[model samples]
Target: MRQTKIVVTSVEDDNFCKCRFCDKKIAEIKNDIMVPSAEECYKNGNVPVPNFGWFCSQACAVNYETKFDINFAKTKEGKIDYYL
Candidate 1:
């Protein structure tokens, strides 16, 4: 039999940090929340994970992505449209 190695993380989300996806307060990682993976995010219209704190929930991430995409649109003539 062989031995296996395990890794542990000390990283903790800032209490004051807000979810980039929803502006909701980020709960402590000690609470054992599930942060969505980048690949998983793409399925919901390419949501972006923050460089720091994560989203409050997966739904918020999806909503955030779609809202961002709504800012732009394609014209009938294949032109890029930007909206405020």
Candidate 2:
């Protein structure tokens, strides 16, 4: 089983860490959380896993891992249209 890494940072200037996958801003109040260790994932002969940063929602996290479009749409001209 693969574990997810979630880094909790202090909210400064009303801004939390942005979602690594979707690039969405995650704003929240500072609180206690239990962060899991990734040492097991890096054990002997284990394949490297990409560290996905903070996420605004679970949907965004899933979309990011699956490479699906959620916050943006692609145009016929191959330009990315952001919905922000």
Best candidate, lDDT-wise?
Answer: 1
- Per-candidate Cα lDDT values, in order, are 0.40, 0.38
Worst 10 residues of 2 by lDDT: 40-49
Lowest summed lDDT window (length 10), candidate 1:
1-10
Candidate 2's displacement at residue 41, Å, is 25
- Which pairs clash in model 2? none
List of clashing residue pairs for candidate 1: none
- Give TM-scores for every candidate, taking all chains together and pairing residue i with residue i: 0.35, 0.32
Clash counts for the predictions, in order: 0, 0
What is candidate 1's TM-score against the reference?
Answer: 0.35
Q: Which tens-of-lDDT digit does each residue in 3-80 have in candidate 2?
A: 544333333344344555655444323343221222321232112213333444544545665686543344465333
> On a 0 to 100 scale, what is the lDDT of residue 68 in model 2?
60
Candidate with best TM-score:
1
- Residue-level lDDT of model 1, residues 1-84, one tens digit each, is 343221213244453334666566443333443333333323333322333334445565546558877422335753322110
